[model samples]
Target: MSQLRTILICDDEEELAHELGEFFEGNGWKVDVCVTGMAAIEKLRKGLAPHVLITDLRISDFDGAQVVSVARELPPEMRPLMTIIITGHVMDTARAVDFMCDYLYVKPIDPDVLLANIGEFLAHRTFPAAGRS
Candidate 1:
């Protein structure tokens, strides 16, 4: 059997985080949820390398950009294959370009659309061979 895909989701809205986690779990992904950016960072630092990361742009104790930045700093093998940022706030074009994410979705995000995008990203990405970064 194929290995299960993993995902980390960080959002200050506890309900949203839980709901997203459940949705992704139901779709066959192993999901981890955090209510703060720092918590998500801690998970990464602890070696919980996930295939994908979905974080809110504005979260408690820091922003999604910082979380993505931390994930990017991980070694190639530990880094997430895809990083996505979701926010309800309207951001300036120049400002939005600063986030280190593969995709940015404005909330309230349609979970189905996000899932489709994730599927497309994973399907198109070329992963490293086993034991390679």
Candidate 2:
């Protein structure tokens, strides 16, 4: 059997985080939710390598950009296959370009659409095994 796909969600909005976690979990993703960017970073430091990362851009502490930056700095084997930033603010092109992430989504996201996009992204990519040259 294939390994289960894992996802980490970091959003200061507790209700939104939990709701997203539940939706992804119900759809067969192993989901981890963090209500703070610090907690998300700590989890990464502790070696919680996930296939996907979804973080809110304007977290009260640390911010999503910092969280994504930390994740990007990890060893290749520890980096997430995809990093997505979600924000409530309407971002202009220049502002959106400031963050390092695979996708930048606006808040009030449609869970189904997000899931479909993720599925499409995964389908077109191959994940190499750790330590492979």
Candidate 3:
């Protein structure tokens, strides 16, 4: 099996971050979990270019959407950074799904479901993942 290029998870919830990190790692992805938007940005700036970024909408820290925006502004050679917004609030769901995220999943995200959809999410792209977990 091939390894995942890279995967970033930015969530304020500690347990969720760990669960996500473990999930991606089990699938051979290089995973990094950040609890804050600034930390996420710092990781990216330090060359942690992940193939996928899973973040939440509401947090005590900076907005997750802003984090996505910052990451998206990177050079094209550095982008196509597939994003997934996981929010509990239905109202914020629309914005996340419509623009910021390629896939916006509500709370209680099913780990297996997400894994199964990974390929379809990148079906239209040709970029290989950068690192393995």
lDDT value for model 1: 0.87
Question: By descending TM-score, how would the candidates be arranged?
Answer: 2, 1, 3
| Candidate 3: 10-residue stretch with minimal lDDT | 124-133
| lDDT, candidate 3, 15-38, per-residue tens | 898898998888887788888888
lDDT of 2 by residue, 1-133 (tens): 1667889999999999999999999999889999999999999878888888999999999789999999999998888888999999987673535788888899899999999998888777666566221
Residue 132 C-alpha lDDT in model 2: 21
Q: How close is every model to the real structure, measured as TM-score?
A: 0.90, 0.91, 0.85
The full ranking of all candidates by lDDT, starting with the best, is 2, 1, 3
Alpha-carbon RMSD, each predicted model: 2.5, 2.8, 2.6
By TM-score, the better pick of 1 and 2 is: 2
Best by TM-score: 2
**Alpha-carbon deviation at 89 in model 1, angstroms:** 0.4
Q: Which lDDT tens digits does candidate 1 get at residues 57-123? A: 8897998999999999998888899999999887657343579689998889999999999989899
Off by over 4 Å in 3: 1-3, 92-97, 128-133
In TM-score terms, candidate 2 sits at 0.91
